[model samples]
Target chain A: MRVLIVDDDPELAELVSRSLAREGHAVATAADLESARAALVEAFDVVILDLGLPDGSGLELCRELRAAGASVPILLLTAQSAVGERVAGLNAGADDYVVKPFALAELRARVRALGRRRESAPSVTYRTGDLEIDLSARRARRLGLEVELTPREWVVLECLAGSRGRVVSRDRLLEEGWGESSEAASASLEVLVGRIRRKLGRDAIRTVRGQGYAID
Target chain B: MPSTEPGRPSSGGRSLVRRVGLVAALTAAGASLATLSVAMVVVDYRVTSDAEDDALERARALAAELDAEARAQQAVTQAQLEDELREFSHGDVTLAVWEASGRLAGDPALPSPAQDGCEASAGPDGAWMVCRASSASAGRWVLVGEPRSQLLAHREPLLLGGLVALIVVVLGGIFAGISVGRWSLRPLVRLQGALTAMDAAAPQPAPSLPRSGMVEIDDVAATIDDLLGRLRVELERSRHFAADAAHELRTPLTKLRTELELRAEEHDEGSHEGRQLLRSVARVEDLGELVDHLLVLASPESALRGASLVSVSALVEAVVEDLDADASRVRLELEDDGAVVGDATVLSAAISNGLGNALKYSKGPVRVGVQDTAEHVVLRIDDEGPGLGEEARARAFEPFYRAPEQRGTGGHGIGLALIAHVVAAHRGDAAFVDDGPGAHLVVRLPRHRGVRPEQT
Candidate 1:
């Protein structure tokens, strides 16, 4: 996976690049919006964006990318955690949002998830246990019965289902499914999982207590 | 009342020591002048009276001598009379005589008598007579006398000189008072100048006040210096707090903004990834708000006390209006004319924070209401959600407090803390109203006047 990181802070950009690199993704860094825009022309699997820039906002760039109908995954980075801000960013067409001072592993996981989502593979369907996801149709079914999930729940399920049998840390789930530093992530995730469990049955997923969750 | 204008240094502006010295000098001068005037008048009166008495006695003796001469029928020549009269005519006296027939006698230079006998005394330019008569040679008589004016005239020069000396002493005393006044007030003037200089040179050491040896001025200067020291300490503390808050906020903001820009750069417009990036940017924004609220809560100025006129109804309306978009599921109900006297900003912030919290936690719609109670303006915000337990409710307003159920709700726990601070600033109280189907938080602020509608 090819990931590009754009940030004004060289140290933070480098740190993010290194973290993503450690996750087996080729990472490139840009310290400002212009260079990052130029790097966007080059084929990249995902982009990790910092909202604040010396010359412009990351949000404007995120909107530009979405307006151009480019399907490359974008993960926005911000210092704020206000709901209105999150809503605005989401409304502006960002796939995910993350607050700064985030854990390295969390950033890596989010980048990996974005990469996986952005790849235009031939198969648009995903299967995990008895659950099946049709990406092209925007539908999920278990036991051939359609399961209704909120947009957020779908993202969470998608990230978890992509990992399939692997343990997905709570932090990674928060960063990938919602945004990093989401105060409501765990509770929201619990609610989502409770709903998912009602449809798919409880034993289909394994809770790892303090560590994470696994789906078999 | 004394004028505030500065007086001349030689006058009332003199130092205390000099003024005291001048007062002593004036007192002595006055005393000397009084003594001199009294002494001169008394001595003049005494000498005049004594000379008159002596002249009267000498006239009796001379009359006796003239009587004995007349009895012997001795012819008295002009020259002989003059020679005899000269013996009585010492300085301060002049003698003359008249016969019983009213004829002038004694040197034949005397003016004719208008009337015989003795007359009341006069002085200076006026003449007065003291007369004595003796029988000579069968009912013929000779009169001997002196003018009283002659005796008083001699002392005129001495009395005039004494009066002049007294006038001079009094004038001198007044001059001395002015000089003394100026000298006495010098130390006070010096202290005032030093204080002015100190104020002008703010943040710098003040020049020492002149030690005029006046205890009162010295004490005043010391007190002013101490007050300045306290002010400086307070200023330094305020500066320290501002610096600490700035440092705390900047690091996180810088990092978050940098990362947001970085992430925004790689995604293309209208892409699924771009939408995620925008959402991330929005979350970053929330952090800025959190920092702002935290700094405001931490500020000492924000903790200031004292109540002002605040309209609870209007404040609630304003806050609800701000939260309307976000609180689409909430309804606000305000009682007419819910007004209170309190810190308006603090109250508003508290109410808004409560509303925000209610909206954030509730699964269903939230409700807010303001009512004018008898003693307080009460505000209540209720949300249809899982209310806190006893333990969570107890520590809800504590700094950085988060319930186990709410830890993953994206709350920093500072919202309730901010509400608490706002309530405290208003000198009001806040508490959980209920724990039933929905969470209800109530705040009460005291009633006050001057709640203008236009101001709100």
Candidate 2:
């Protein structure tokens, strides 16, 4: 899969690039509107955009891409998490919106989701140890027995399963699922994980303390 | 200190009720004194005239008796006439008998008598005469008279005493009027003091004027108290609205910032589009901070609620120490132990904002000082930046006002406005002073006598 990232902050752009590149996707970057426009004309699985730019806005580019009948998923990046901005960004044809000072892993997960949606892959199944996740069925099974999970718990389980043996940081989980600060996400994540662990057994997931959590 | 502009009218100058009452009291007293003095003079004149008429009638009766004796060829001795005259003299009147030649005839002690209308026609003396006379019988005339000056002399002391009494009464009345007026108006004076404090942005408890028997003054006091209550309510309403509006704006701003970060993740390092997105996010963050400052500036009620006894020096020192990492170039000086009773949150916010503003504008270094003065607790922040012009300094405390040069700065222009509001809530004032190349902002709060010492 190929993903294009457009942002003006060098540090943030580098962080997003490394995280997405680690996910086995080919990554490309554009710092401004002109370069982003040129990249949109080429083949790409997804485009990540920042709303404010030196020349033109990311929302305007999102609208133009949609008007040009480009169906590739475009995610918007903004500093303000205002509800109006989120509505405006999505209304301009963006598939998702993200706020800054975000964790890299969350950005990677969003890109994968966008990619999967773009590819239109149906009946996708994911397996980690005894846990099995079926995208089409929207259900989870462990040891070949069906498992009941709330919508939020299912999202958390999927995130952990998607990472497999790797650790998923608390910040990434918050940014990807809750769309809020890590402080709030960290607290909420504890409750969600507790529910999931109760249903799946505690030994299935491992806590990394300050770093993150991993599932085997 | 900058001189305030002349010609701006003062709201409370002289009150009308006080002036009118004073004038009315003085006039009534003066009129009463004048009427009493005139009455005393008339009474004295009438009494003297009546006494003189009684003595004149007795003298005429005596002379008729002597004339009847002469007609019978019976001589009357001068001794007997003298004894009759002596009886009339008992009440301080002296009488004498005179012949037709204007010579003293009966009494040797009498002076040579002057000829007058009483001698001319054997009738009563003319209205101007000192004596009254009438004929008895036998072509012999009888005269009885006393000097009018003696009667007038007695009347002189009484009249003088009455005039002196009148003056003493009038003086006593004026003294009484002033004492009564002041005693009666004491509650009004207290009410005026409370109102003045309220106008200066001090929190005053509701006025409780003692009920003066005077109906009109009591009404005026009550009306003033009602007006103060209404003004306080209006101010509270405006403050609440500003706080609510700010709270409402925060939720959306937070959500927008979260979404932007999520979108930025798809781009690669060194990408042209990635950098532009990052810059956009920073701008939104600045806007959110500005909004928060505006909310604090607009809501004075929040500051008023948290009033307490706090050490001004301690608050300044703590805030400066906490901000030291961010303000390496700034220096803080504690000049005196600044202690005052005020809202802790309000005082801290005001002091910190002053320090923040100093840090933002200064090029070299900023200095903060806390001092306790005789009348006020003072907090001063001096900066090494380009100082404000005279016009900007004058209008610095107004909400949403920025100096012309500072308009381009990325602030909402409410930093000083917030400080001003907080100062006002604590019964204080904020002002600007020149500090060489920079400006010094000072806040002075009234000293609170009951301020507690620092805990540790």
Top model by lDDT, which number? 1
| Model 1 regions more than 4 Å off | A1-216, B1-29, B75-92, B99-103, B106-119, B122-153, B160-164, B167-218, B233-456
Residue A90 miss distance in model 1 (angstroms): 44
Q: Residue B223 in candidate 1 has what lDDT? A: 77
Please give the lDDT score at residue A37 for candidate 2.
Answer: 86
Question: Model 1, range B20-114, lDDT digits (tens) per residue?
Answer: 66676679687977798688779877865676467557767777777788888898886787788787666645566556565444533333343
Taking all chains together, each candidate's TM-score versus the true structure is: 0.33, 0.50
* Tens digits of per-residue lDDT for model 1, A1-216: 988888887877775775566557898988888898888889888888877789898888888987897777778886543334554676576777665455444566667666656653222576766567675334656555444333455566666666777988888778766666476567657755654553344554678888888776
For model 2, how does the per-residue alpha-carbon lDDT over A1-216 read when each residue is reduced to its tens digit? 898989876655666676667668898999999988887778999899988788989988888887887888887776543334554676687866555444445566677677765654333577766667674334555555544343345456567667778998888777555766657467667856754553344555789988888876
Alpha-carbon local distance difference test for all models: 0.65, 0.64
DockQ of 1: 0.04
Model 2 residue B42 CA deviation (Å) reads 4.2
In candidate 2, what are the lDDT values of residues B307-425, reduced to their tens digit? 33455665675566557355577676765546565555456667877888878787777878777677897888888888899999999888778999887876666778888877876
RMSD values for the candidates in order, in angstroms, are 20.9, 15.9
